[model samples]
Target chain A: MKNWFRAAMAIFWKDILLETRTKDMLLAILIFSILVIVIFNFAISPTPKMIGFVAPGILWVAFILGGMFGLTRSFGLEREGGALKGLLLAPVGRDAIFYGKMAAMFTLMMVVEVIVFPVFAVLFNLSLWIPWLIPVAALTTLGIATIGTVFSAIAMNTRAREIMFPLLFLPVAIPTIIAAVETSGVAIRGVELAEMSRWIPFMGAIDAVFLVICPVAFNLIIED
Target chain B: MDDKPAIEINGLTKSYGRTGVLRGLDLKLDWGEVITILGSNGSGKTTLINIIGSLTKPDSGTVEFGGIGVRARATSIRRFIGVVTHEHLLYEHLTGYENLRFHADLFGISSADERIIIVARQLGVEARLNQLVGTLSHGTQKRIAIARALLHDPPLLIMDEPESGLDQEAQGMLDGVIRQLAESGCTVLTTTHNLDKGTAMSRRIAILREGRIVYDEDLKSSTGADGVKKAYASHSGESM
Candidate 1:
């Protein structure tokens, strides 16, 4: 178990360092996410009552697009030069690979969230005063990335990788995305965390299910 | 420490849809031994290597590594096997030092910086350690891949045509490296169509034809023109 943890951390660190140095996925995700927010801000006329009606949907749009952008590029380079094969050759267990990749995706999404929220706070002009909402945002991002990374790795093996990712990811991830947006909007609207107790449990269930499912699924897909 | 077979395959088989690729192949290899496998383009060489490496599961038959059932304990069995295929298995964006460092970390080896420097120097890649793997020459990339494989120092090394795409000098250097690896008590199994290099580096040569082993012989004893002709003729199903 110790070795597995060590190995997973190593893989996680490698992804973070690689992405940071190049800024490949982060750049694309930021641009697309900002564009998404900008379009939503301008295209839809924001009235006092309409803010509550559309804010949830707009935030979800940004999250979905940004997360999918991340998913497409996560394993792209690894597949290209056969680095995935090298990873397989390592002595570490397969579960470590899944967990390590999840950590990388989780970190990247957090960075994007940090950038997105301040802009979101200003644009919507809603007082999201609750401190715990930040942690909730991180959890939602984790849920998005955990499932997205596995599908990205799978799509990397296919020919049309760029298109395959969003097509496959969006359909399966709808429930989680909807739950995240609803709960996040509730927090932003000054509702107590307890008001989201029902949805919070559902989010936890999604995380738990994918946490177990993705690792088992990844092993099968990665096999030659 | 016990006298366990380094690799054992019993009636291994693989197929693609309706077409058969490998049919009931059996092999046994011991530790600290070198074996060369030669085959034509589509003769199941890669399939056999993939199965042994646990990259692909076999359709039938069983493989045991160091007396541990490969299918049952694959994750544990991986500790004993290292594979170097034709694929350039180094990440292109990562510098050589970072790449090796990452691999060392994957194996959970502490003090990775020291080990990375040592292996980089051993492979004559110390000068290029900071360079991105994509910018390195094909030979240098191959060297980095070999260094990555040796980081864990698995007893069994399975290489598929490690000399491909290398110039004459690079090939000679790689041959020396393989020889040195063998001398250090690492079991080496390699596949190559180049008879001279295969014969020089391997004690035993197994010639594969159309997905079957047609000839397995000790290269030291095999002599002259008749040996070469007979081996080919036998594989071709023609009597000479």
Candidate 2:
């Protein structure tokens, strides 16, 4: 157990350090997300009365798009640089590499959300500056990143990497994304924490199910 | 520290679809020995190594480490082995140091920071440790890959063409590492198409031809290098 933790921390920090130096992934995903949010704002004239009604959809759309971009960068770097084979040869447990990558990607997605939510709130004119949405955001990102990490590994091996990620990912990410959007919507509408219970539980359930499946599936995908 | 043979295989067979790769192959490798496998392309040299490394599943066979079945105790048995292939398996975006450290942590082998520095020096890659592997020369990257394999001090080291991309100097360095490993009582299994280098480095050599061992002999034999070449040529039906 101690060894696992140490190995996880090593992989986690290594990725963090790489991201810190490059900043390419964060820059691309953030710029792409903000552009999408800005385009949505311009395309839809969300008046004060209509803003709250559309806020959740906008947030969900932004996250789904942001996550897709994040997943591409996550595995693309490893695949392009030929680092995937090195990771495979390491004496570490294959599952640890899977979870470590999921964790790093999950953190990156959350950071993107943290940055985008405020920009989104102002653009949609929705009072979404709620404290409770933090956990909801974290849960949503975790679910998407977990499943996305696995699919990204799969897509990384394919001939059409750019097009394959979304086709393979969006369908599978639906349950988690919908549950997240619904819960965040409930929160934005100033629903009580207790009243928003169902969506949160649903999000947790989705996360729990995929988290267990992703690690096992990842081993099968990388073997080729 | 037991003196058992590092690897023993019996009737190892692997097939993809209707085609077979390894066909009831049998091998035995003992400690302090360096064995080189030579074969024409598609003769199942890589498949055999992959099975022994537990990277690929064999259709039917038994691989044993110190006489224990590979399938029954893969994890514990794996702790005794390491592998390096044409893939060099280093994360290109990460620095050489990061790659080594990650593998060290994975094997749960704790080494002082200085020890990592020492191994990097031994591989002539200490200066490149901070550089991203993607930016390093192929020879330098292969050295780092070799360093990662040695990080855990496994008793059996399996390398598939470790000298493939290396320059003459780097190849010489690789030979030194193999010899040093053997001198230290480690069993080394390597694959190469360079017949001269293979014969020079190994005490016993095995030639795989069309998924079967066509030649297995020791250095003391007077069969000469041409005899092994002709045997492989006749068996593979491919001109060298």
Which one wins on DockQ? 1
- How is the predicted docking of candidate 2 categorized under the CAPRI scheme? acceptable
lDDT of 2 by residue, A1-224 (tens): 67667767777776776787788778877888888889989999788777666877888887778778778878777765456765655556667888888899888878888888889988777665687788888888899889999999988888898799999998998888778777777787777767578688888888999989998999788764
Across B1-240, the per-residue lDDT of candidate 2 in tens digits comes to 365567889888889999988898988888777899988778898888788887777889889888788767665666678888777777777789888887777677755466678779879999889998889988898899888888878789999878788999888888898889999988999988777777777778888876778788876684766666666667767686
Query: Worst 10-residue stretch by lDDT in candidate 2 chain A?
Result: A80-89
Clash pairs (backbone) in predicted model 2? A83-B91, A86-B89
- Tell me model 2's lDDT, rounded to 2 decimals: 0.80
Clashing residue pairs in all predictions, respectively, total 0, 2
Cα shift from native, residue A152, model 2 (Å): 1.7
Candidate 1: deviation at residue A59, Å?
1.2
Give stretches of model 1 more than 4 Å off: A128-132, B224-230, B233-240
Candidate 1 lDDT over residue span B89-141, tens digit each:
88888899999988888777678888887777777889999999989998899
